[model samples]
Target: MISSFLLPLLLWSIERILKRKQFGWFIVIVTLSLVNNFYFAYYQLLTGLIYFLLELFFVINTIFYQEKVQSNVLSLPHYWH
Candidate 1:
C-alpha cells in the first residue's frame, strides 16, 4: 500500500538526480529506502534486508556512474560557437 505511494517519488528522485546531478535527491532516495526497510521489517526481516541491500547497491552504482559521466564531460575540450 505505502510502497505504491513511494514508488513514484523514488522514480522522480532518480530522474532528478540523473538530470540535475543534485546530491539532495540521492539523499532523498536513501531516506526513502531506509523508511521502506523499517516499514517492511515489522513483517519480514529477511525481505526488508534484501530490499534495502538492493536499493543501496543501485543507488551507489548510479552515483558512481554519474560521477564518471561528469568527469568525462569535464575532460572533453569545449569549442566556442
Candidate 2:
C-alpha cells in the first residue's frame, strides 16, 4: 500500500535531483504502477494513473517553462538592439 506511493515518489525525486532532465522516465514507471495496482495492490488503476499523470505534467511544465524563460532572457537584449 504505502510502498506503491513511496516507490514512485522515490524514483521521481531521485531522477529529479540527479538526471533532472530525464525525470519523465519516472512518470513512465509510475504509469506502469497503474497496471501493477490491478494485480492485488491496495490502490486502483485510476489512482495510480492520476498520480502519474499529475507528476508527469509537473515535470514537463518545469522543463518547458525553464526553457522558455531561458530563451526569453537571451532574447531580451536583442529586442532593444
Candidate 3:
C-alpha cells in the first residue's frame, strides 16, 4: 500500500525530465525507490517508461506534422535564407 505513493511521483518526475530536462528529481526518486524497494519500484519504473514512450510518440508526431505543414504551404523568401 505504501509503495503506491511512488507511482505518481515517478510518473511526474519522468514528465518533468522529458519536458524540462530536469534530471535531479527523477534521479532522486529513482534512487530512493530502488534502494527502498526494488520489487515495487520495478512496476513503478515500468509505468513511468510507458508514460515516457507515449510522450515521445506524441512529440514526434507533432513535430513531423508541423514540418509537413510548413514545408507544404509556408514558403519563405529566398532572401530569408
lDDT of 1 by residue, 41-74 (tens): 2334344445556767898999999999998888
Best candidate (score: TM-score): 3
User: lDDT per model, in order?
Assistant: 0.61, 0.61, 0.86
Q: After superposition, how far is residue 76 of candidate 1 from its true place, in Å?
A: 0.8
For model 3 the TM-score comes to: 0.79
> Please, what is the TM-score per model?
0.44, 0.47, 0.79
Consecutive 10-residue window with the lowest summed lDDT within model 1: 40-49
What lDDT would candidate 3 get against the real structure? 0.86
Give the backbone clash total of model 2.
0
**lDDT of model number 2:** 0.61
Worst 10 residues of 3 by lDDT: 72-81
- Over 29-57, each residue of candidate 3 has an lDDT whose tens digit, in order, gives 88888888998888888888899999999
Every candidate's CA RMSD = 8.9, 6.4, 4.2
**Tens digit per residue, CA lDDT, model 2, 20-73:** 556665555555655556353335434545665777789799999999999999
- Where does candidate 2 clash, by residue pair? none
